[model samples]
Target chain A: MSAPKTTRAWILSNPPTDMPDESTFKLVEQDLSELKDGEVLVKTTYLSNDPAQRGWIQKGVIADRMYFPPVEINAPMSSFGIATVIESKAADFPKGTLVNCLTNWREYAVIDTTLGAPYVTRVDPIPGFKETHFLGALGLTGVTAYHGLENVNVTKDDTVVVSGAAGATGSMVVQIAKKIIGCKRVVGIAGTADKCKWVESLGADVCINYRDADFKEQLIKQTEGYVEVYFDNVGGEILDLMLARVKRFGRVSACGSISEYNNSSPPGFKNWFEVIANRITIKGLIVLDAGARWPEMIKEISEAAVSGKIQVGDANETIVPTAFEDVPKTWLKLFEGANTGKLITHIV
Target chain B: MSAPKTTRAWILSNPPTDMPDESTFKLVEQDLSELKDGEVLVKTTYLSNDPAQRGWIQKGVIADRMYFPPVEINAPMSSFGIATVIESKAADFPKGTLVNCLTNWREYAVIDTTLGAPYVTRVDPIPGFKETHFLGALGLTGVTAYHGLENVNVTKDDTVVVSGAAGATGSMVVQIAKKIIGCKRVVGIAGTADKCKWVESLGADVCINYRDADFKEQLIKQTEGYVEVYFDNVGGEILDLMLARVKRFGRVSACGSISEYNNSSPPGFKNWFEVIANRITIKGLIVLDAGARWPEMIKEISEAAVSGKIQVGDANETIVPTAFEDVPKTWLKLFEGANTGKLITHIV
Candidate 1:
C-alpha cells in the first residue's frame, strides 16, 4: 500500500468551559511522508473515549500531574486507540501488525518506539471478539476495571457496589466482580432505568437508579447490608452515600468522577468521618498506574473474555461508524448516556 | 501494699453533645470486695486521655465502632491508663507489676487478663524514662502515631507533613518521622506558635501555624513541592489543605479529627478531588488494628525514647497531680488547647 502523503488531525483550539464541543477542536492536515528511524506509522481503527479526557482539557492543572502530557492547544488532541501498522522501521512492529497506544484522533499515528515503549503494545487480538475489546473489555480499560477492584481487595463474600455502572469501565467492573471474582452480590448504581437494566444483564445482582427520589433508601434495601468494596466511578453525593454504607475495614477506589467532572464546586463530602471511624481505605486509581506489566492483566482479561465470562461490543450490530467530524459529539455521548456498553468510534 | 477496699472513680452522667465539660461527668466511689479466677486488680497511676474519647461518647457511633466499648451513662468512663498491679488472680500478671490497659478513670481497676490479653500489656520500664512514657511515648498511643506514618509508607525521600503535630500522638509522629524514619523533611501543621516551637524542638524541619492568616502561603513555600505523606491527626481544613499538596501516588493517614470532634456541622472538605487527581491513598488507622503484635512497636518506641531521641512527659517539673473531681475538667484541656504534649490525669 502506498504511504499516505498527509494525515488529517484534530487539535485543541481552546479549553472548553465545562465540556468539549466541536468549536474546542480544530481539524488540520499533517504531512507524515518522511518517517524517522525506529518510527512506526499506524492507521487508527478504534478511538477510545474516557472520562479522563475532561481532566486533560481542564484549565487548572492538579498538583504533581499525570504521566502523559495534556492535550495542549494547537496540538494534536491526545487519545488512546487501536491501529494497524502500515509502515515501520521498528524491529517489534511490522507491516499490517495491530497495536495499541496513545493513538490520536486522526487517520494515522507516527509513533517513536523509544518514547512509546511504555504504552505502545502489540495486540494479540483475542479470538471471537471485536478488536475494540483491546481498548474496552479486554485491554487497558479492562485492566483499569480489574486493578480498581484489586485495590479494594475484593473478596468472594463481598457485596461489591459500583457507581456509574452502565458506563464503559464501571460495566466491565460489575461483570468481572460478579462472574470471575465470584462476589456474593454485585450491586450497581446507574442514572436511568435502561442503564440499570443493561447493567443487570451483565450479571449484577441488583441495579439501583441513582435518579430515583429514594436512591439511598433503594441502595440500602438492595444491598441488604454494608458494602465491603465500593468501586466508585461517579464522585460527589454518590460517593458520600456509599461511604455511609461502607462496612468496617471497607475499601473504596475513586476511579473517576464523571458526575463532578464538569462542575466547578462539586458537592462537599459530609460522611468523611465515617472513613476514620470504620478504618476504611479510600484510594484513587488512574488507569496508567497499571504500568509496564500489563501482559499479565491483558492475559487475565483475554482469558476471561474468551471463556465466555466477559462481554464486548456486538460484532453483528448494523453499524454506521462515527465520522471524523462527529468525534466531539460522539465523545459527548459518553457523558450524556447515549451508549450502553463500550463507547468507541470506529475510524476504519 | 495492701489492696484498696474502695476505689475513687469518675462516671459519665450522659454522653456529651460535643466536648465533655464538668457537668457531663460525675465523681463516685467504687466498692470492691474480691477477685474472681483470671481477674487482676490494678491501682491506677496515670489515666491517659485521647481524642478518641469524644468519638466513644458521640450519640452517632461511627460505624465499625472502636476497639474498646463506649463509656456508659452512670457508669465508669472508658479510657486507657498505666496502673500498678496491686492484687492478681491471673498467673500472667503479678503484684507490683506495672501494667498498661483500659484502666478507666479510677484509683483501682480489676482487669480480666484472658480478655485483656489483646489490650492489657506488661511494660518492662526503661531505666531513665518516666512511667508515664509507657502511655505517652512507648505505649498504644505512640503506636498510633508510628503506624499512621507507616500507613502512608513514609520513606527517607518523603517530605512528610503532619497535622496536629503538638498533640500527644501528633508530637510522637513528628519525632518518629524525623529522628527514626529519617524523612527528607518533616513539616508540622499546628495551631499556636508555642506548639509549633515544641514540634520543631522535637526535630521537625519546619513547623507552620495553621492559625496564621498566611498559613497556606507559608505551607506552599515551605513544602516547595508536593508532600509525599500527610500524617493527619487534626482532620478538617488542615487535612483538606494537606490533601491538596499531596504528590502523585502520595499517601495520607486519617489518624484523628480533634477539630471536628465538637462540631456536628464540621466544615466540608473541598479538595478531595485532589485525591483522585494525584492518585493518593487515604487510610484510617486504629491502634487496635495492630492486635497481638504491639510488642514490636513498644520495643521500637522504647529504644527511641531510651536513646534521648524521643520525649515522654517531663520528670523534672512542679506538676500538680489532678484531683479526682477535676478529671473531667482536665480531659477538657485537650480540646481547649490549654495543654501541650501528652494530656493525662493522675488519679492518686
Candidate 2:
C-alpha cells in the first residue's frame, strides 16, 4: 500500500494546570510531507497510555526538568507505540514490517530510523506471545519493575510491599517479587476490590484495598509486623503509611507518584522521621536512566514469559480499541482508575 | 581515695511534652552500694551532652521504639561520660584508670564492666590530645561523622552540604568531608555568624547562616547550583530546602533531627517528591549501627588527628565546668544552639 496523502494528528493545545481533559489537546488534519531517503512511512497500530504522560503535559519547573523534554505546546504529543511500515526507504524497515518506535498521536507518520535510539526501535514478534506484550510486560513497564527492585538489592528473605499493584509497573513488580525473586511475602495495595483480587492473582500473597477503612491495620496484620522493602508506585498518604511500617534498615524504591501527579500541592510526609529512627534507605527511579541495560532485562522477562513463570496474558492487560476521534477520552481513563493492568489503545 | 558513702544523682522526674527544662529532673542523694566482683566504683569526671538525649526521653512510640530503652521516669538519665576508677574488683579496670562508659547523672556510681559493650569501654588517651577529644572528635560524635559520610558513600568528586555544621557531629562531618575525604566543595549550615566562622575554620569551603534571609539564594549561589551529598543533622524545614537543592542521584545522610525533637508535630517534608524527580537516595544513620566498624573508623580518625589532618583540640570543643546542681540546665543549651562544637560538662 502507498503512503496516505493526509493524516490526522493530535497536538498539545495547552498544558494542564491539573489533570488533562479533552480541551488539553487539539486535533487537526495535516498534509503529509514526502519521506526522506532514510525514513519510513508507517501507520499507527497501537498506542501506549501511561501515567507519566500527565507529567509531560504539566507546567513549570517539574515539566521542564523531567528526564526527557516536555512535549512542546501545539506539537504532536509523543509516547511509545507500535506501527506497521507501509512504505520505506531504509533497508532495515521493509514494507509491512511491524516496529515499535516513538510514535505521535497520528494516523500516519514518517520515522527516521537513522536517528537511532529514543526514536525508532525494531521489535520482533515472538511466537505464542501477543504483540501487545512488547508494550506491557516486555516493554518499559516490565523493565521499570525489574530494575527498580534490583536497584534496592531486594533479597529472597525480604517481605516486600508494593503500592499501585494493579497498575502496569506495579503488576509487573508484584509478579517479579514473588515469582522470580521469591520474596518471603509480597503484599500489594490497589484502589478497588477487583483490582486487589487481580493483583493477588498475579502471584501477590495478599492485596489490600487502599480505600478500605482498615487498610493500615490490614497491612500491619498481613505483613506480620514490618516490611523489608517497599516498591512505591503511588505516592502521597500511602507512602507515609508505608514509611511508618518499614523495618529498620529497610529499603524504598520510589518508582512513581501517580497519586500526586495532578495535585498542585500533594500531602507532605509527616512520618519522614521514621527514616532517621529506622535507618531506612530510599532511592527514586526513572526507568529511562537504565537504557543501556534494557536488553538484559528484556531477555530475562521474555524467558520468564515463555516458561509461564510470569503471566503476560490478557488478564495482565487492558487493551481498549479506540476510534480515531476518541483517543484523548480513552487516555483520560488512566487517571480515573477505570482500567486494570497495563492500559493500551488499539487504533481502529 | 575511698568510695563515698553517699552519692548525689539527678533522675528524670517526668517526661517533657516539649523541650526538657530544669523541672524535668529532680536531684536526690542516694546511699551507695558496695562494688561486687567484676565491678568498679568510679567518679564522674566529664559528661557528654548530645541532642540524641532528647530522643531518649521522648514519650510514646518514638521513645518506645528507640535503639535503646528510654530513660524511665524517676530513673537517672544516661549519656556517654568519662570516669576515673577509684575502687575496683574487676581485673581489667584498675584504680586511677580513665575509661569511657554510659553513665547516669551522678557524682559517684558503680559499674559492672562484665556487662561489656554499651556499658563500658576502655579509652587510652593519646599524647597531646585532650581527654575531651574522646567526647567530641574521637568519640561517638566523631565516629558519627565518619560513618555517616561513609554510609552514604560520599566521594572526592562530591559537593557536600552539612546542616548544623557547628554542632558536635556536624563539626566532625565538616572536617572529614573536607580534610579527610577531600570532597570537591563542602558547604555548611549554621544558625549564627560566629558558628559559621567556626565551621569555616574547620575546613568548610563556606558556611551559610540559616538565619540569613537569603540563605536559600546563598546556598544555590555558593554551591554553583546543586549539591551531590547532604549530611542532615537538623531536620524539619532545612531538610526540605536541601532536598530541593540536591542534584540527580544525590545522597542524604539522615543523621539527626534536632530541630524537630521538641515539636509534637514536626513540619512535614513538602519537597519529598523531589526524591523521585531527582532520583535521590536518602539513608538515615544511627552511629550505633556501625559499632562493628568503629575500631577501623577510630583508627583512621586517630591517624588523621595525630597527623594534624583532623582538628580534635579545644578549638573543636566547648567544655563547660558545670556545677553539680547545673547539669540539666547545661544540656538544654543544645536545643538553643547555644554551644558550639562538642558540649562537654566538666563535673568538678
Candidate 3:
C-alpha cells in the first residue's frame, strides 16, 4: 500500500471547565509519512478513553508529571490503543498482526518500536468477547489493578474499598480484589447512583454513591470495620474519608487522583495525620512503569475473561466505530460520564 | 530487700507552652505496691527524655487526638524508661536483670507482667558503654531508624535524605544508611547550624539547615539528583521539599512529622500532586509495632555500637541524671534544644 496522503486525528484545543464539552477538542487531518526501516504502519482498531485522559487534555499535559514532555498544543491526542499492523518494515512485527500501540488518536500511523512501546501478543481474539477488553480489562487498567493489589499484598479476609468504582481501573480493582484476591468484602464509591449499582452488580459486597448527602456515613457503615486496602482513584474529600477510616497499617494504592486532576489549584486533605498516626502506606503507581509484568497480568486477565469470570462489555452494549473526526466528541462524552463501561472508537 | 514504702515520681500539673519550664513538671513521693503473681518489681535507672516526649507533652497526647489523660491531675507522669529488676514473680523474667520498661516517671514500681506491664529481661546490656545508649541508640529511636530503612528498602545506590537529622531517630538513620546500607550520598536536614554541623560529623554526606534562608536551594544543590529514599522525620516544608525532589518510584519512610506534631494546627503539603505523578511510595512506620524484629534490630545496633561502627553518644558527653522531681524540667530542655545526644534522668 502506497503511503496514505492524510490521516484523521483529534486534538484538545483548549482546557475544559466543569464537564468537558465537545467544543474543547478539535478534529483535523494530518499528512502521513512513508514507513521507514524499523518502523511499522498500524491502523487503529480500538482507542482507550480513560479518566486520566481528562487530566491529560485539561492541562494539555499528563498529570502525575510522569511523562518528561507535556503534550504539545494542537497535536493528535496520544493514548494507549490497539491497532492492526497494515504494513511493516520491522522484523519483529510483520503485516496482519494485531498490536497494542501507545499512539495518538489517529486513524493510521507509523510507530518507532524503540521507544519502549509494547506489541500485543498471546491474545486469541476469543469469539463472543468484546475486543475492547484489550484496552480495559486485559490491558493497562487491568494490569494496574493487578500490580497495585499485588504490591500492597492484598489478601483474603482483608476489607478493600475502592473509589471511582465504575471507571475501568476501579471496576477492575473491585473485581480483582474480590474474585482474584479472594477478599472477604469489597466496597465501592462512585459518583452516580447508576455507577454504584453497576459496581455492586460486579460482585462488590457494598457500593455507595459519593454524591449522596449521607455518603460518608454510608461508606463507614458499608465498610463496617476500618478499611484495610484502599484503591484510591478519586482523591480530595473521598481520600480524606478513606484516610480517616483506615485501620492501622492500612495500605492505599494511589492509582489516579481524578478528583483534583482538572483543578487549577491543588486540593488538600484534612485527615492526612492518619498517614502517620495509623501507619498507613500510600503509594502511587503508573501502568507504564509496569511494562515487565504486562504479559503475566494479561495471562491472568485473559484466563478470567475466557472462563466468563469477569465480564467486560455485554452483548447489548453499543460498539460505536466513529470516524476519526468524531474522536474529540467521544472524549467529551467520556468526560461528561455519558458513556458506561468501556468507550472505544474504531478508527478504520 | 524489703519492699520500699514510698517511691519518687514526677507529675505534670498542666501542659507546658513553648518550652517546658521547671514548674510544668513536679516531683512527688508515691507509695509502692508489692509484687503480685505474674508481676515484676522494677527499679528505674535511666529515664528517656526524648524530643518526641517534649512534643508529646506539648500536644497533650501520644498519637494525635488521643489525649494522655492529662497526667492524672496529681499522679506521677507516665514515661518509657530502662529499669533494673529487684524482684519478680514472672517465669520469663527472673530477679536481678536489666530491662527496658514503659512505666511512670518514678524510682520504683510493681508491675503485672501478664497485663503487659513493665518487666525485666536478661538481654546483654549496652556493652560497657554509656548507660544512656539504652535511651538513644539501643532503644525505641534506634529500632525506629532500623525498621524505617529496612521497610523502605534503602540501598547503596539510593541518595537517602533524612529530615530532623539531629534528633534521635534521624541521627540513627544517617548512621544506619551510611554504615549498614552503604548509601553513597546521605543528605541530612536539621533545624540549627550546630545541629547541621553535628549531623555532618555523624557521617552524613551533606547536611543542610532547614532554618537557613537558602534551605530549598541548598537541598536541591546537595541532592543534585532526585532522592531515591527519603527518611522523613520532620514533615511540613521539609517533607514538601523532599517530595518535589524524589525520583520516580522513590520510597519515603514517614517515621515522624516532628515539625507538625508541635503545631496546634499542622500545615499540609500543597504539592501532593507530585506523589501521583512521580509514582512515589510513602509508608508510615511506628517502631513499637516492629515487635518480632526488635531483638534482631537490637542485636545489629548493639554489635555496631560495640565495634564502634555506629557511634551512639559523644565520647566526652556528660549525662546528668536528674532526680525524679527533675524529670519534667529535664524533658523541657529537649524543646529548647539544650541537650546534645541523649538526656536521661536517674530515678534511683
> Each candidate's root-mean-square deviation in Å?
4.5, 3.1, 5.3
Instruction: Write candidate 2's Cα lDDT for A1-348 as tens digits.
Output: 455898999989888866788999999998788988989998999998988787777766454246666788888887778899999999999988887887788888888889775367777888888878888798889989988998899989998899999999999999989988889999999999999999998999999998999988898788666889999998888988898888988999999888888776666565766888789999998887767778888888899889999889888789999997889988999999887889999999
What DockQ does model 1 achieve? 0.39
Top TM-score model: 2
Q: Order candidates by TM-score, high to low.
A: 2, 1, 3
Q: Give model 1's docking category.
A: acceptable
Residue A266 miss distance in model 2 (angstroms): 3.3
Question: Who wins the lDDT comparison?
Answer: 2
Q: What is the lDDT of residue B167 in candidate 2?
A: 93
RMSD of 2: 3.1
> Compared with the true structure, what per-residue lDDT tens digits does model 3 show for residues B66-91?
22233554667767777777888888
Ranking by lDDT: 2, 1, 3
lDDT of 2 by residue, B1-348 (tens): 556988899998888757778989999998888889998888899999998888777765455246667888888888788999999999999998887887689888888899875468777879989877887788788889999999999999999999999999999999999988999989999999999998999899999999999988898797666889999999888998888788888899999988888886666565666787789999998888878878788888899999999888887878888998999988888888888899989897
Instruction: Indicate whether candidate 1 or candidate 2 has the larger DockQ.
Output: 2
Q: B1-348, model 1: which lDDT tens digit per residue?
A: 567888888888877666667877788998876899988899887888888888777765643455457666778888888888888998888888888888888878788878764368886767877777777777767888887877667878898888888888888888888888888899998889988988898889989998899999999898777878988887878887787788888888988888888876666555666777788899988887776557687777788777777776572111337877787777887788656777878864
lDDT (0-100) at residue B305 of candidate 1? Answer: 76
lDDT tens digits, residues A1-348, model 1?
A: 688988899888878656667788888998876778888999987888888787777665542565457777788888888898899998888888888888787888888766653378788766677777777777766788888887778879898999988888888899779887889999999989988988888889889999899997998787555878899998888998888788888889989888777776666565666777788899998777776646677777777767778666572111227777777777777778666667788774
Per-model TM values vs. the true structure:
0.83, 0.90, 0.79
lDDT of 3 by residue, A83-140 (tens): 7777888787788777777657888888876554354432348676666677777777
